[model samples]
Target: MMEISSAFASGFQGFQRASDAVTEATVNINQQAAQSSNQRALETPVESRTGPSMEQSLVTLGSEQINAEANLKSVKTADEMLGSIIDLRV
Candidate 1:
């Protein structure tokens, strides 16, 4: 029984770590995408009128922000759940 509980705790901890890694990767990807879009807009010829518009970029940024927030919330919730489980065990 003790070994089982220990294994469960380790599993939860591993899950939490994985969640953190995923969240970090997501945020990095979003930042890179925004940067790439902005860079393209700047590099494009003004007369050509090509590349992502400011409005579109803003919308994308907003969505990415929301996504990052959601991921953060997930991490927090997972931490809370792990804590609750430990409390119950004790």
Candidate 2:
């Protein structure tokens, strides 16, 4: 009977050790997961919201392009007129 009791005590100790090991492993895994989540949050950029509307930006760009094209046409017309005047003089 004494030997049986000793064996039971040893078995209980082994079980307790296994439980403690499982608890330690769980804690380590939770810590690693939390750290990885924090690292990812820090590495990513926050969403941007403040900027010009897409339509408005496109309209401004189109206006500038039209103004530039008109200026180029006027310069070409002036150059042709000057060339014609030079030809007449010649």
Candidate 3:
């Protein structure tokens, strides 16, 4: 009986660790996304034939990047929530 309880406890701890790892990874991804956006904001467009202004291009690119980041955050949130639920079950 003691051995069984110990095994169950060990498994639970492992599950908790995995949840923590996922949370860490999600945070890191979010940080990277924010940094990438900042870098994009600082980038200047190369001289080209008259067309859209550099500011306009930057705006469009930034908007697309923001949308992508939002989607990624949503996915990470869902994954974190799922992990929490699983941890609770365990």
Candidate 4:
């Protein structure tokens, strides 16, 4: 039971990390968008493109969303497992 609780704690930490990554990605996407717009206004050539491409940013955001959802599922599963164990012991 101690081990199970530890595992769930670890899982929760992982979820927290994933949530941080999502936040970082969102900030990066916003920065990239601003940079791209500025570059466009300057009529910069495509060869001089900087930061992540719009498509790449969108893909990253999508993947992060999936990861967050998976993490949430894991946390829920862990909670249910713990509950079951407690009920069995009782």
Candidate 5:
């Protein structure tokens, strides 16, 4: 059905976005960590950094992981519904 197909597309897109977001947040965290270590090694003053804090990035990662899970579930539900429809028709 159109609804099921749409659900499939929506879920897939949502999952992709969440995955990208998680990846971005992870990269940001890693970059910040690397900068910190490098700074400490050099014994230089902490450079002014402008961006989401580590805590915020961690939160984003956590929330995006949850979103990815929910989107995967939605895709699975849509697939199951499609399968049930085919089973009924056949």
Candidate 6:
């Protein structure tokens, strides 16, 4: 069905978005890790720790991984459906 192609496209887009988010989360984690505690303390007040913390970045990374997996599954399902359609036609 036409929906199969649409599902494949949607899944690919979702996977791309998840991959980008994972990259951003990794970058945020690296930045947070690279910044010295002393420098952060001096620059930001105790109450003003506005940037993403290591825990949050890690969580984001995990969530994005799950999202990517789900998207990949959708893509595989679409591929299978397409293959079935071709087989039936033949």
**Candidate 2 TM-score, C-alpha based:** 0.46
TM-score of each model, in listed order: 0.48, 0.46, 0.46, 0.75, 0.97, 0.85
Model 5 agreement with the true structure over 1-90: per-residue lDDT tens digits: 999999999999999999999999999999999999999999999988898878899999999999999999999999999999999999
Lowest lDDT block of 10, candidate 2:
45-54
For model 6, the stretches where C-alpha displacement exceeds 4 angstroms are: 37-48
How many clashes does the backbone of model 1 have? 0
Per-residue C-alpha lDDT of model 1 across residues 1-90, encoded as one tens digit per residue: 455455556655655655565555556556657666887889953343345455555555566556556655555665666778789999
> Candidate 3: where is the Cα deviation over 4 Å?
44-90
Clashes of each: 0, 0, 0, 0, 0, 0
Backbone clash total, candidate 3: 0
User: What is the lDDT ranking, best to worst?
Assistant: 5, 6, 4, 1, 3, 2
Name model 5 segments beyond 4 Å from true: none
Against the reference, the lDDT scores of all candidates come to 0.59, 0.53, 0.54, 0.78, 0.96, 0.90
Task: Indicate whether candidate 1 or candidate 4 has the larger TM-score.
Answer: 4
lDDT (10s digit) by residue, model 4, range 1-90: 787777778778877877887777787788877777887999986454466666777787788778878877877888888999989999
As a whole number from 0 to 100, the lDDT of residue 31 in candidate 2 is 56
Candidate 3 lDDT trough over 10 residues, lowest sum:
45-54
Model 4 poorest ten-residue lDDT run = 45-54
Instruction: Give me candidate 1's TM-score against the actual structure.
Output: 0.48
Instruction: List clashing residue pairs in candidate 2.
Output: none
What would you estimate as the lDDT of candidate 6? 0.90
TM-score order of candidates, top first: 5, 6, 4, 1, 2, 3
Deviation from native of the Cα of residue 26 in model 3, angstroms:
0.6
* Prediction 3 global C-alpha lDDT: 0.54
| Residue ranges of candidate 4 with Cα displaced over 4 Å | 42-50
Clashing pairs in 1: none
Model 4, C-alpha of 32: deviation from truth (Å)? 1.7
